[model samples]
Target: MRFSTGLAAASVLMLASAAWAQEAAPVVASVSAPASEWRAVAAENLLVIDTDKGRVLVELAPEVAPGHVERIRLLAGRGFFDNLLWHRVIDHFMAQTGDPLGSGEGQSPYPDLKAEFTFRRDSQTPFTAVAAPAGSVVGFLRSLPVQSQPDALMAKMEGGRVSAWGLYCPGVAGMARDDAPDSANSQFFLMRQPYPSLEKRYTIWGRVVSGLDVVRALKFSPNPDGIVTGPDRMTRVRVASDLPEAERPAVQVLDTNSARFRALADAARQAKGADFSVCDIDLPVQVAGAPAA
Candidate 1:
């Protein structure tokens, strides 16, 4: 199903402010982190989508939405997403696809997935906080931005863990469903900009580590329904691990837990002042030895 129509106006306003902030903020010099501070993304968890626009690389977060990740992996491996049209797209919002029928109503023969809007996070979870406001802590878990209850509350919970959910930052990937919370099937969307209102209401499975510009360049529909007359299609989709070794792209992300990352986050917070948000920070990514887009 489509997102709540009420969000469209709010999204436009938010996008305007975000654009202004991006233009006004001083550019921070790229940090040179130690090699130890760089972590290579697992090939199996990296999704490569070659669209008519360009190549988009997404780093899947199974820890947050295992079921959805598995579904994506299975379908991509089976080439189910190949040539699937991006049927619905909204500027400064998101692009929706993954329907084999090229219409919003289709799905894989597999069953619909249950909602995974929240996950339990314990001390073992790799979380690096950028901001702690009152009762909630906002941070990054790998490449995905997240918000969760304070770590102190974990001890009070039954399983020594607290509930956490992914933030709908720009480039976030989320499964789309009908009004029913558990109706998510094959369709999903890639965020074009930040929209915090979707937090905890949708299951976030991954975040784009590279080529977000390509996502933003997708042709958007002028129709209020977001249905495109002629849409761009996914030429091919595959898990990095499934590709031949020589063809696979080597990807590395700046570790969020590293001191260099903390310094970068601090710089961003200071620059944005009260308007600061974890989404304002774009983690550094390095890609090497990949076939040309």
Candidate 2:
């Protein structure tokens, strides 16, 4: 399903058109809340990618995929992503980059990472339920939407806790792998739309908390496999932590643990009903330069 800003994705089941077609207001309003309900984007977990179109700010998900996140930090810190072309960009699918070869064949000198498709959820995990329509529970682990088994069944599992994985929502970033699940290396992709098919199949390690329009504005390759000729290059990529203090992007995301977030989730549930998918709602974010008062 495609979940774009302020619009339901094509894959999302449409409810009564008459009712939902005009219900965008509630969803938009829910995006704004008290400043107290928000938190700053830690420099250690932020990625800033500059392209010709614009800058794309990604919030790394270390808790979900620590190894992959560390790889991103290590690579970016060393200027490995500079001038890397977005070699593969499928329309309405995702834009893949980080391949030094610019032909989907090259990767960094780093060794291939084992697939981190899912992570263990424990009591310390700050997951807030947005919906529980079926046996599965849909919620937020910070800014990422996740679907997992119910709590009752979690304790009986081998890990004695529920298994949760990030949904392949728009603006989500994932590793690009070969046929083998463990072949992912330096290559990665940013989703242009929500694709449930990729769930549990790719390693979701971060999300674009801002500049999604810039992501959409990216030029796609004419080729069917998303290989662009003279593709736009990432002028520079850097982990915020490595940047000078004055130059860092001090971002803030809506705290899922806040009452405001729960209210928004409730409003969304009321708006979509059985048709509601967690991807339908994009997490709200702001920069430190102009935080909500």
Best by TM-score: 1
* Model 2 spans with C-alpha error above 4 angstroms: 1-26, 30-32, 289-293
Candidate 2 shows a clash count of: 2
Report the alpha-carbon TM-score of model 2 versus the true structure. 0.87
Cα distance off (Å), candidate 1, residue 9: 9.3
- Per-residue lDDT of candidate 1, residues 1-293 (tens digit): 34434334445565556665345432254979889999999999999999999899999999999999999999999999999999988776788899887767788899989999999999999898999988999999999999999999987998899999999888999988777788788888898877777777778999999888989899888765677789998999999999999989999999998888888899989888887888888899989977644
Error of 1 at 269 (Å): 0.6
lDDT of each prediction vs. the true structure? 0.86, 0.77
The per-residue C-alpha lDDT of model 2 at residue 32 equals 64
Model 2 residue 91 CA deviation in Å:
1.6
Q: For residue 228, give model 1's deviation from the true position in Å.
A: 1.4
